[model samples]
Target: MPVVSRFLGIIIAMYWDDHAPPHFHAKYAEYEITVNIRTGVVEGKFPKRALRHVLEWYEIHREELIENWELCQNDESPKSIEPLE
Candidate 1:
């Protein structure tokens, strides 16, 4: 997986080869979450305390993020994520 975005306490990434439900990974401090790119749902492991930041970022970037995720799934290059500031 390559990192798509990185900020203070969050790192977003997508695996070079992954399956569907269309998701991405977010790592914050010591916790990690896999979020569904299309639905703002946590599709996999997510510790409670780290959910807020992940959800916030997802809400802001969901559209682009899901597009990037599909590119990753297809083995095509995807545009990376940009930090807000």
Candidate 2:
């Protein structure tokens, strides 16, 4: 997995060959979560303590994250998260 961002203990990243439903991978030590950017859903298990920050970050950048995912899917480099309009 290639890390795209990191803050506090959270690491936001994307795998070169990720599976369907297209999402980002977040890992804080042993805790990991696959978040669905388009729908703001957590697809896998994550630590409750980390959940709040994760959701907050996702809510703030969901649209851009989805767009970045599309770019990644197209074999193009991911873009920075743009401000929500």
- How high is each candidate's TM-score? 0.80, 0.81
- Which residue pairs clash within candidate 1? none
* lDDT scores in order: 0.77, 0.75
Compared with the true structure, what per-residue lDDT tens digits does model 2 show for residues 10-44?
Answer: 88887655767879988888888888877777867
Q: Least accurate stretch of 10 residues (summed lDDT) in model 1?
A: 43-52
Candidate 2 residue pairs that clash: none
Model 1, CA-based lDDT: 0.77
**44-81 in candidate 1: lDDT tens per residue?**
56556467667777788888987897788788777877
